[model samples]
Target: MMTLRRKLTFLVALAAAIPVVIMIGLTLKAQENLVLQAKGELNLLMRTNLAHIARDIYALCDTVNDVVAKDLDMDLAAARRAMAKCGAPNLGVESADWDAVYPLTRQARRVPLAKFMLGDAWLGQSRDPAEHVPVVDEIGREADCVCSVFQLMNEKGDMIRVATTVLDETGRRAIGEVMPAVEEDGSPNEAIAAVLRGETFRGLATVITNRMFSVYAPTQDANGKIIGMLCVGKRPETIASIRKAISGIRIGKDGYVAVLGGKGRFRGSYLIAPKAEDEGRNLWDRTAKRPDGSEHHFIRSMVTNSVAGGGRAIHFEHYPWPKPGVTGAEIPEKTGACIYFAPWDWVICATLYEEDYHAAADKIESTMTSLAVTLSLAGLV
Candidate 1:
């Protein structure tokens, strides 16, 4: 057991092994530090992208909203008389039973058939109808967003799209459509309900083909009774220059930036994703099992934490799924940063796989193994 050659070989192997172990330990410590740093970077990336997206779209809506306050002044009585005489308000969609029954105490503020009687068809270009509404086209041109006027149909809180720069599915002017009193789910339509209460409703609302970041202001008569609603909005996805930038962001090797609608009807739905793989789908309803065998409602937790940040804070979450919006097939723990942009109800998220961040450690360990074998062979020689 104590042969001189065996003793010398053992001593040489031990010397090689000691430094390799020490070097590996040091590399691992450095890798751990790098990973912790990358997590912060991931979270920062989310907030930066979130702000980048929120700003431009918000500016578009605000600019149009501001221009409307000064330009849109309608005399409902004059509008109704002129329209009714000319057989206008002809493109109207019939409102729901809820609107027909809701007792709006200030129904007197509503001009008879006003919702059904559009003053003029302002279809992106100024054409003289019974009542001329040039602002719809003017503002739409100025800000490159949608502009429309919705006259209150009744005290039942129904509003009709009388003049609009908005186009229908077929690309013609979307006019005379009744803005319903409630959502398709029979729940109060938040934007419409807020306008009925004489407050500006600012969030996301449907503008023809998609939900847009929108602003809706109540038009009131001299007696302070709401007569109609002035609307302005733009699709966040089609926002002038930022959509491409937001969609192209990559947090790490496989990590990416994405957006989910955080409130109302769009809540639980994916607003942005790579290739639009699951856009318009509710991706937040499912629960997933984590790598640690714990049940996790990843999306719900991410959204709640982002909202809790109150628009100024950035929050991080450890999600255990490999893909965004999909449940099951747990990953090796992913970390993401999320922030809520309430204006459009978007939950902006940036995520990276935990293993990706520790790639340095893996590489170092691999290199150390090779180095250890080489050093031990040299010692044996």
Candidate 2:
């Protein structure tokens, strides 16, 4: 037979263990649910960011197309067909060759370029502060958004800024300058190439110092041959309000949202990060090795999974990132949800340290243990 002390000890042990077991079980279940909910919310955020990017691009495209359709009265389909046969424009080609394919004289007479030029000249000479040139005024009116850029390019891709809400360093419109054949990164620009080929190009591309979400549409002459391009661009900073809003979302201690560019020359590039130093870094090439000394190819795997799942929150993987301003030091075990936004080629991730979750469970356990001890002593007395 057990002594009274032994029986009391057994009861106390049982009292202590029961609630702890229940608490642990409940904590595990709650943690699972919380993680799941967080992942779902992260996926929604990724999609929302992507949609915002697409909306900016589409809005720019619509603005340019509307102006071209209403003012120029050119058929876009016929223009596309005609542009298909023109081959790529040789920027260095002789004037004779240009005249043979795209006659400047005929186009000048047919379109409103001459009128806009006249208006530009008038605006330059006019003393009246409120006097707006007719064609320039029309374009300015269409450029409703601040920081928007609208340009009419010649067949040679020389751009004339008819109206711009974006200003140069001098706070004046960049008028009558040839658009650069290449982007700031020195890559042949896909958007310009598409328009030059007489096809509409809508995508993200770098313009000047700012990476812009751009839309390039072919503007044609009376003969339905592509004569020029209508370009509308908005800097990503304009749409970065979404990122600014989401950046504050914290997932345990130091976890935050991170954005990576998924396509174009900037593919695998970091777009947004809490650490300023991490921005613009190539994520795919900068990944750390796995525990087994194998290359994890973190960026590639994340992009592939997110793309395949159509931006769904696919999986959580261990992500090792260097601590800011600390060399050779990495976060022990950080995990993140990978999601892709196809429209802007963005990879959005929300990450948290695994230890944080464990700590919460530990805290609950500690509290339960204290409660059990108090109850067990009372029963013994």
Report the poorest 10 consecutive residues by lDDT, candidate 2: 94-103
Best by lDDT: 1
Instruction: Give each model's whole-structure lDDT.
Output: 0.61, 0.53
List ranges where model 2 is wrong by over 4 Å.
Answer: 1-137, 145-203, 235-237, 312-315, 325-330, 363-381
Query: For model 2, how does the per-residue alpha-carbon lDDT over 1-381 read when each residue is reduced to its tens digit?
Result: 999999999999999878767766665566666656665666456445444443443344345445533432233233333334433321221121111111122122122343222211322322232554333334344443222222334554544434334454555554333454454445555666777687877555544446555566765545565544655554456546555655566665766767777655566777777866667787667576777998788777776676676654454556676544557655566676766665556677767666666565566556655665665555445
lDDT of 2: 0.53
Q: Which one is best on TM-score?
A: 1
lDDT of 1 by residue, 268-351 (tens): 677777666677878776677767987888888878777777667667777665565556665566666677766566777766
Assess candidate 1 and give its lDDT: 0.61
